[model samples]
Target: MTDQRPQYGELATPEEQRRAAGLPPLGEIPPVPPMMQLSAPEPVAQAPNPGRSRPVDRFVTIGLLAYGLVNVVITGLSYLDLPTVMNESMKILGIDGEFSNFAQGKLWGTIAAALLVIGWALTAALAIKRLRRGKVAWWVPLVGAVVTMAVVSACIAVPMFNDPAFMAYLEQMSGG
Candidate 1:
């Protein structure tokens, strides 16, 4: 018997055949206008302002940076004299000259002071950078300031409270 069924490709209409061939139907697509044929115009480039910080923020940042630098310097100077201070403190407590113990205490005290100063300086620097970047979070600098004050106060207060001389001075000053 002869085969009578249409071939698979030939079963589609002309338009479907055109689409199946990955082409548009004749007279279907419109030509691009001459204006669109040209390349698109380049976008304008804008220069970002590097000095974008406001006056108040700039002032606060500068202050914080200065405070950090001062803390670093003072802490360094204090560390340099730490051995002498420790010896005197030991003498005040009626302790005999034991260089090894004094040296160990001074070493630990210096390390603690260095860490505290470095941490405070870093926090201040970060807050200054954030402020300069136009961030509005006031708490960044505030927290740094508070922590710095607390650290300094603790460093000063602990020795004063422990030392008989300092406590006596305070008592004399207070008339008690």
Candidate 2:
């Protein structure tokens, strides 16, 4: 408080002040222009509603979530009746083979179900994030659907592939 020099822990806002404090200019700084009449800031093209979503975006979110809910309910019911369906189909096809590891198939079904729900949630989250940021988000759900179905299909195939008679029939049909 006695001298005109800076005290400890004081920030150097000006280049001259920084130089006086034995500090070099941090980096390339535009040279200061002479004082002139102030002007309004350059008009920035602003968003219609920053950080606020539109009706369409909300509709997309809700519609897809409802779609996911219906899918979960129906697919869950199918999985619950999977064993009976397998037996019936096998009888109709005249295949005498049984499931070697029904527990393993159950595990795969669980994994597929979990992945399907997680994929839907993740897709919605990504779309919402981009929509909030005022970005084009129409493609997210499509891509998510493709990838999620591919993964779920692969997971669901394990159980069917575990049947030896099915594999033998496939091999016979393939000219092997």
Candidate 3:
């Protein structure tokens, strides 16, 4: 014999329970409306292959990383040559002089090189993290370069301004 107990949902009303028990309706009780249709809501639109390839963002991020690599190498090479650094630092200051503090100037160059390397590494790491998370990361390298170079510029400035020649030139210009 078929079991009369409710087979499924616990929300069965008294009438449903009774119907499951196969009792005739007492005094014309209205039939329970058919259970509401429950289909899954339309699936959220997702980016194509969210678990797979995100090629465009990856390409741009890598390209930007390559650009940063080139810049860091060129800047490091420039800082390696002391004569060029001496001339260029003065040139940047608009002064016809060389830094007498060769050791101190080289120290600044070293600091700049370190900053460039560190900045490149950090940008690469951040970009890789973003790419893995499927985020746009093309701008990280550019922003990293801008921030690192600003600090490097300040580092270069300290020795430049501390030089007697640079200070004299500034005094000469300011009429002090």
- Candidate 1 — worst ten consecutive residues by lDDT sum? 96-105
**CA shift of 117, model 3, Å:** 0.4
Q: Please give the lDDT score for candidate 1.
A: 0.61
By TM-score, the candidates rank as 3, 2, 1
TM-score of 2: 0.58
Residue 58 miss distance in model 1 (angstroms): 3.5
Which candidate gets the maximum TM-score versus the true structure?
A: 3
Q: Which whole-number lDDT from 0 to 100 does residue 105 have in model 3?
A: 76
Off by over 4 Å in 3: 1-54, 91-94
Error of 2 at 75 (Å): 1.4
lDDT of 1 by residue, 95-169 (tens): 544223344445555665776676666777677566655665345656775776677546544543554555555
lDDT of 2 by residue, 1-176 (tens): 57876665475567767677687686755655553224336655545552465667656756776776688667755655455555666678777775555775677877877888888888878877877777766677778878888898888778777877667767877999
Candidate order (lDDT): 3, 2, 1
Worst 10 residues of 2 by lDDT: 31-40
Error of 1 at 157 (Å): 2.0
lDDT of candidate 3 over 61-149, digit per residue (tens) = 79989988998999877866544676776788688777776777788878888888998999899988877667777788889888888
Return the lDDT, model 3, position 60.
76
Per-model TM against the reference: 0.45, 0.58, 0.64
Clash statistics: count for each candidate = 0, 0, 0
